[model samples]
Target: MSDADYFKNMPHDKNDPNPFLAIYMDQSIPFNEEAKAAYLKDCSSRSRQFLLPVLRPFARLMIIVLQLYKIIVPKALTSSRLLHRVLHFGMKTFVSPSANFMILRHFYLGSEVLGFIRDNVPGVHIEMNPLKPTKLEPVKDDLFLIHDLNLYNFVINLNRELREKGTEVTAQKQLNFSSITSSRIPIEQMPRRWTNFMDLTTAIECFTPVYQLFLTDNDFWRATNSLQLDETIGILASKIIGSNDRLALINNKHPMVPLTTLKAGFRLVLHGLATEQLHALLVELKLKQQKEAAISS
Candidate 1:
């Protein structure tokens, strides 16, 4: 598996005004107006682009619905045994097994990349405090993680418990990218599924402003952190990966969920794939450069 520093000092384009986009941007798959235009294209039935463009409309509506729903049923945002049961049931029975793998794998990879960015890049602040008001060490568990937000919560609590125990970093996000990406995951995972895959983008783009369009920054945090939709989708990336389902591995983050756990998880798939897609393009550029240099020399 490639280490976290695998791309250490790797040459990435720094032309974009946004730092994160700049880190991932490349000339070939340039993150420009053209790439943004293609963001909604129906690339292939198997490609993530296929369903995401379609979901943007309804998902935009659902954002207001989720917000109003939050206003009406605030408790649904928090931990609920019943909601977990419903989410678990909907996932296990309705979501395809291959799709589950894709969702979980996306989470697994997403966690790694998020962590990588935070570690490698600057100004991508992701700070967490230990769980306090409790004497017990963070409850040591074998949970796998799928979402970084949940991870944001877990390690805060998990390390609080592991504090001064001399334990090595066992949190899943610490693992190399290839640990999950190169594994025996099924190919052609899904053709039509990926429920929350586009939710984040939809919320940011069509639902926020009266232009009612794309969340900039403050709103993105307000929507995800304040609105707590992540808790709602945490099943696939959080519970299934940690606190509950399958998303964690490698001590925890790098581990795999039992196929049985898919019966009870919900998560996103596109954003992470988009990140990986850019990284792959970067790798391709390097390979091409190597070939040209070798021939010229």
Candidate 2:
């Protein structure tokens, strides 16, 4: 079934044998005994077939690398004000706008979910804090678990409404050279100021979680590195440093690049911990099924 159809047909009843409900839904109400038993059995089979073997070694390697980095890097340098400033500036100047835009989209979707829950769900208090450019925190409460699921539902419903009114979004036109030149003129004319520095720091702070999430996804990592990630890094460095000669001097030798790469790797390790947690829950469910099956047989 298509993804939209799958989500649309998701069973609301607790007794329904949908595995996604177990993982994605709030489980305040217990499922019927028979349905729970069947779900447990399904979890066991799926875990053994699809989850454990692939994830176990990946998790182990991730932990080892993170531990080693902690041992090798001094806390003082890691926390240096100048170093952080440089890193922030480098990231802002070098990272593609596409990445920044995608992260912003996630924040937007999250805000929409918060609003929906607040207006619709009775007795569930939702926090309405503004999205900080720095420091993206989790929702204050469990009122919006399964953010992606909720965002998908929100978008689908919105599109349906728009379609019923015979309205469709138009495609964006390509930007011309004149438009691009005009956009850069303002920044070129402006003098470097403290607020610019503050904005850079704030952007870094807000982007940390988005970067972590992006790095943790194995597919994204693979796709990013497929064309030699260092090559693009080199180009960005050349532009910032104003010479290919300086680029060669630093090149792949810069500590910032390695440090950022390591940070991303470490974040992936943390992601592995989350995966392990889910795997453990599935294993427990599987064992429960086995015990019940033995009792029945």
Candidate 3:
């Protein structure tokens, strides 16, 4: 019987039931899930599933809303300072640090995933060169990155190319994020603001049992890493960064399906200015490195 005809899943190879142990055995995973949820063992509630025909008007209204709003939404990043700061508080409080970190990590992970496809596939596969990883040097107040992690990552990518050729920079650098964003949103307000930034850990430990009543870490990770996910966000980064640096291997893919909503467009804008400022910082570093080399020689 075809898999399409019924719910079907393959049997796990008992001899190698846990294959991830082999795949990542030598490498340190950049993110770790610390929570042990008994909920994952519980069977899903198979409640009656039926789409209500009564909600047709509500669905139609949403379509109309999308049609009206999509026309005015900006397709790329914005330069407005006020808008960045205004959205700062809400995004900081409601969004998990782990979500922000993984999304930031997506900039690299997506590129790597696509690259593996290109090298492995023989027929008309496109090249996907991984972006150079920017190793942040130890600095005071580094935790401020949790304030606007997307912008922080955007800047890192913006400077990566220039840093690659200009000088033999030590694989360490301090980011003065204030130079990029002067927002007075105190870093203290961000959860776990004092935690070590360099550690390869996740904020999954922070979710409380009360919060997990509806959706546990298992649901969150599965959703966050896949659909309802950043594959779309990856699409945005690919477009902004360069034509060659795109993440989606699937043709005709967009960050938003059917429509790009106003809120989604605003995210692109948030990454704009700080990305610009971070570029300037790297440019200055290149010049400084050259000047020091000249003086010593």
Candidate 4:
């Protein structure tokens, strides 16, 4: 999106001194008190004036409620420490607050699986093909939802682990891929639902943060890092996704490619670069979070 569009759509106060608004209104009307009064009187004379005036005020109230909810709610509500405002938008539509905690726990399992994928999976990159972007449109929504939850779980787990280990006091404020990735354990072998659909690592990457959240100590992490990929996938399948009755039905009825295979396919098709890209993505994510934090503070 263009910067102009982004700022224009952004929520702002009636009294906001935003430069974007200044530019938008420049030469059209003066923004002083007298101009505002005349503008209101003119608007009052227009048809649908009452309805139109109410719309902007109502929109502002909604924005306030949303921001307030973001500040009041816990991060686990949507499996994210960042983007709670946006994520909560989804919940307001699709999810019930009563079930938020259960969903959050499921997300944690997914995060741990993602952790394994980062360290061990063969190099496969996500090349955003402009021409072919629409080809895989069907599964993209589900995949994105899965990734969003995983990232949330990862932040929560990482923050907790860093706090417990006394590794660094500012760990919550920074990203540490090495520390997190190095702690991954191999998947435990068991009845697995994901074997047919995803590469073990790729599937795990989809949801490892959720799994990592419940971990006890360094010993558990050490043990997990050693498990075979298949075994770990199976463990996750049975304990997390497979256990959910609604999701289990979807898995059993319509098994797509295995998560392991999907990873390889994504890498081959997309042809991604190294972890350096991750650095950029992480920086953007953090900056957005910091901005939100500042707004809330």
lDDT of 1: 0.33
Give the TM-score comparing model 1 with the true structure, all chains together: 0.34
Residues 196-273, candidate 2: write the lDDT tens digits: 222222233333433323223332233222213233333432332234442232122322232333234334322222
**Candidate 1 lDDT by residue in tens digits, 19-94:** 3333434334422222232232212223334555664566556555554555555444342233334434443444
Ranking by TM-score: 1, 3, 2, 4
Q: Tell me the tens digit of each residue's lDDT in model 4 across 1-297.
A: 432354446676778765545544453321222222222222233222343344444433443443344455523234323333333433333332212222332233234334532332223221211111111222223433444334434434544554666642211232323312222122222222322222212222322333223222232232232222223333222332223222111111111222322122123112111121222233334456567779999
Model 4 has a clash total of: 46
Select the stronger candidate by TM-score from 2 and 3.
3
Which lDDT values do the candidates have, in the order given?
0.33, 0.33, 0.29, 0.31
What's the lDDT for candidate 3?
0.29
Model 4 reaches what TM-score against the true structure?
0.19
For candidate 3, write residues 176-270 as lDDT tens digits. 22112122112222233433221111112121111122222342222222322234334333333333221332222332453322122123222
How far off is residue 293 in model 4, in Å?
Answer: 32
Clashes of each: 25, 2, 2, 46
Better of 1 and 4 by lDDT: 1
